[model samples]
Target chain A: MTGLLDTLLAGLALGAVYALVALGFVIIFKASHVMNFAHGSMLLLGGYLTAVLHEHLGFAGALAAGVLATAALAGVVDRVLLQRLPQDPRAAHVATIVTIGVDILLVTDLARRIGGDLLSLGDPWGDRVRTFGPVTVPDSRLAAVAVSALVIGAVFALFRYSRWGLSLRCAAEDTEAAALQGIRLGRTRMLAWCLAGALAALAAVFLAAFPATGLERTTGQIALKAFPAAILGGLASPVGALAGSLVIGLTEAFVITYQSDLHVLGDGLSDVAPYVVMVLVLLVRPNGLFGAKGAARV
Target chain B: MSDAAKHLPRLTAAVVPLLVLCALPFYLESYWLRIGLFSMAAAIGAIGLSLLSGTAGQLSMGHAFFLAVGAYGYVWFSGDPGPGLPPVVAMVLAVLLAGAAGGLFSPVAGRVKGMYLGIATLALVFIGHHLMLTLDGVTGGFNGRSVEPMEIGGLVLDSGRDDLVVLGVPFGAEERLWYFGLVLLAFTWFTARGLLRGRPGRALAALRDSETAASVMGVPVARHRSSAFVVSSMYAGLAGVLIALSFRRVVPDHFGLVLSIDYLAMIVIGGLGSVGGAVAGAFFVTALPLVMAKYADQLPLVAAPGSPDGSLGPTEASRYLYGAAIVVILLWAPDGLHGLARRLRSRLRSRLRREPPAPPHGPGPAEPVTPAPTTTAPSVPVKEHTP
Candidate 1:
């Protein structure tokens, strides 16, 4: 029972981080209709910035700088690279593939800079644990859950109240209608990309915090697990993304916990457990659990 | 002009390339030949990917998984501690095995639409990687297994065999593999072209354009979608066999998401829905890094591998180039290199036929050459037409 509880707590923290990243995915998808494949690299960029600057600026300052820099980078990528292309709904898919190229370039440059060295982000919650009854949880994990909950709540509130959020929602519903309503589509799209980048940067801190060795080249790849999370919830649904992240998080945590019992799958099944759960869910619900069933008009 | 007169240039264009490729092994050194071999293998895989993603409008990221099935299947079926089948039979079975793997996944592949399908296929890469690592007996666990050299009749393709000299050049494993890769690539080219031009290709294009419309026209939507997966996997499998043969050893690490991304890049860079484009894209993508690394000394910005900390390495430079190319091509010329070639050819033809005034009703003669964004800006999103 303790083991199960411990695993569940760990899963919650993991899920929280995934939710942040998945929400980023949902935001980008809702705005531009292009899945930002460069998201992982963006997360890496944020983490890399924090790692490199923490020594000079202190942890908090570095974190802020990292978040701002990544947000700016995301905005530039949208404004310069993505926005230059015509917004043809038909060619939107091609535009999505272009993100892959951006990802490769960003990832390559970051990986080269890091180069087999694991650099710490100098986060305050270093190797500290707090006990709750029979279960002891790492402080970093607790911080992850708390920070993610706070951030995600703020995001949800923004969606519920902010003018940009309203414009985003409207644009997602009907681009033509939104455009006619004079909701600057281009600005909203850039803002959306910026928000997603900021969220990705925040997630990077908790991801590279205690328990994880440090930030490395492959840290960005860990963000890829969130792809299933975002997709599982349906790309357009924020609530779905949160729910999907939890499901994926719990699945991975449990899979790792019970690896010895389930030896037939070989070791390291937890690494792919989220994907397995995703496939099973997708097989049952094609558009994801909460995805709107699109109507086709000939 | 007579039909024969019209066909003469086309025939010469086709035959000349074929003859040149056939004679390349004798002329080129081992290093260049090896690159050609790898490029040919990549071309086969890219062709398969083009058929599935470009023609059928299914964005599959599980291509590497199918390629793995082909490669490992060949190794297990042909080598000891397993079936020990004939090399030719093993090769064929491997392709079938890959197709079977695709068949197994057809449930999701058939049901899922566009971007969703792409994400769904990603599961195959991670799951397949786990299986490859765990299934130690078959896949040789982490280290992987050395591939058995292909033996057909009395001729052994392995370097261990006695050397055969031809035209003062000693025929080695690279030389032997060059011909093998060529035959496989040629087979891929003709068959892919045949499929694209035949009934299935029309049906697939229709499916891509609009699934409901295609279904209304009696196209078996699910069957065709699933079968495209199978055919694509088979091609990936063939490519895997050739790759395994060239590599002499197969490792699980090589067949990862990066490989799938490379395949996608090839199809996109070459021009989606164009077979020749896939081949060209594959060669450019596969050769870029290799050629860059080889000539690192000559290049301005690039340093040799393991030179220093700050300088740009050849691998990094090539990646930057291709990555920038993908963005630039998509923005400037969405149709890709094949489209560019088509535009150039049309322009040349029009220039030669300048005496006749062009029809005003049709697309302007200069339009194709220029890659006018106005014409292609609103082609249609992948999801809009799919029900």
Candidate 2:
């Protein structure tokens, strides 16, 4: 019973971090229709910035700088590169492929600079654990949950109340109609990319925090787990992303914890478990759980 | 020009390149031959990817997984502690195995649309990687296994034993594999071109343009989509087999997402839906790193592979070039190298036709009185060039 509770708690923490990353995916896809394949690279870039700068500036100052820099970078990429693409929806795939290219470039440069060394992000939570009744949770895990909840709540509110969010929703609904209504598609997309970038930057801290072996070049790849999370909920729905992330996070955590029993599947099944769950979900729901079936125009 | 006159240029364009490729093995040394071999293998894989991603409008990042299936299938089928089938039979079975794997995934492939399909296929890579790591009996696990050299009626494709000479060049493994790759590539080229020009090709293109419209046009959308996946997997499988043979070894790590991305990059850089473009892109992507490494010291901004920190390595330099190429080409010439080539050829043809009869006694040809409009811009309609 204790083991199950512990597993569930760890899963919740993992899912919270994934929620941050997956939400970013949903926001980007909602606003721009391009699956930012470069999201992992952006996350790594933000984390790298924080790790490198935390020594000079305090951790909080470095974190702010990293978040701002990443957000600005994403916005610039959208405005300068993606905006130049043809407005046709079919061009979305091409833009997606372009992001893969951008990812390769960013990852390559980062990997080269980071080399084989692991760097510390200098987070406040450093392996300290808090006990609740019979359950003990790492401070970093608790911080991840708290931060993600606060940020996600703020984002949801912004979507509900902010003009930019309204414009984004409108643009996603009907680009032509939104343009007619004078909603700037370019600004909405840029803002979405910025928001996603900021979220990814925040997620990176927990990803590289306690229990994780600091920040390595390949830490970006761990963010790939969010792909399944975003897909599980449907690419366009925030609530779906949250639900999907939990499912994926729990699946991963349990799979890893119960590896001995699941030895038939193979070693390190945890890494691939999320993908397996994703495929199963996608098999049943091609558009994902919350993804709407696009009406055929022709 | 008359029909025959028009056919002359196209005929020469095709035959000239074929002749040059056939002649290459005789002239080139072992190092260059190996590069060509790898490029040929990449071309085959890229062409397969082009069919699915380009013509069929399905973006798959699972190509390397199918490739791994083909490679491991051949190895297991022919090696000891397995079926131990004849090499030739094993090769055929391996390709069929890859196609069968595709057929197995058809449930999702048939249902999913473009971007969704791309991410769905990502599952294959991770899952496939895990299986490769765990299935030591078949895949030989992490360290991997040596590929048995192909044999046909006691004539070994591997080196030394057969001791056959062609044109006194000393027929080595590279030389033998060169001809083998050429035959396979030629078959791929002709068949892919035929498919593109035929009815199924039209149906696939229609499906890509719009699914509902294609179904309305009497196309079996799901069947065609699955068939494309099967055929593409077969091509990838064949490429994998050829690659395994060329390497004389197979490792699980070789067929990963990076390999799939490389194929995607090749087709995109070459020009989507263009067979010749895929080949060009494959050769460029596959050979660039090797060539860079060979000339790393001579090239500016590129250092040796393990050079001190901060300096750009050969592999890194090539990656940067291709990554930038993907961005720049998409921005400037979305149609890729094939489109660029077509435009250039059309411009050249127009220039030749418009060359005001060389001034009788002038040392150089006279400039046209009116400013000749640039024909290089993709926007300029190449009406006369279109078939």
Top TM-score model: 1
Candidate 2: C-alpha RMSD to true structure equals 4.0
Model 2 CAPRI rating: medium
Q: Write the per-residue lDDT of candidate 1 for residues A1-298, one digit (tens) a residue.
A: 9999999999999999999999999999989988888999999999999999999999999999999999999999999888877686555667777888889889989998999999899999999999999999999999999999999999999998999999999999999999999999999999999999999999999889989989999888877899999999998999999999999999999998999999887888898889999999999988898999898767
Q: Write the per-residue lDDT of candidate 1 for residues B329-381, one digit (tens) a residue.
A: 87775666776677677667766655377647465654455545466445522
lDDT of 2 by residue, A1-298 (tens): 8899999999999999999999999999999888898999999999999999999998999999999999999998889887886656665766776888798889999998898989899999998999999999999999999999999999999998999989989999999999999998898999999999999988889999988978899988966899889988899999999999999999989997899999998898998999999999999999888889889998
> Best-fitting candidate, measured by lDDT?
1
Question: Which residues of candidate 2, in runs, are more than 4 Å off?
Answer: B1-5, B305-307, B353-387
DockQ of predicted model 1: 0.68
Candidate No. with top DockQ: 1
Task: Indicate the TM-score of model 2.
Answer: 0.94
Tell me the DockQ of each model, to 2 decimals.
Answer: 0.68, 0.50
What lDDT does model 1 reach? 0.88
Tens digits of per-residue lDDT, candidate 2, B163-202, equal 8889887989998888889998999888888887799888
TM-score of each: 0.95, 0.94
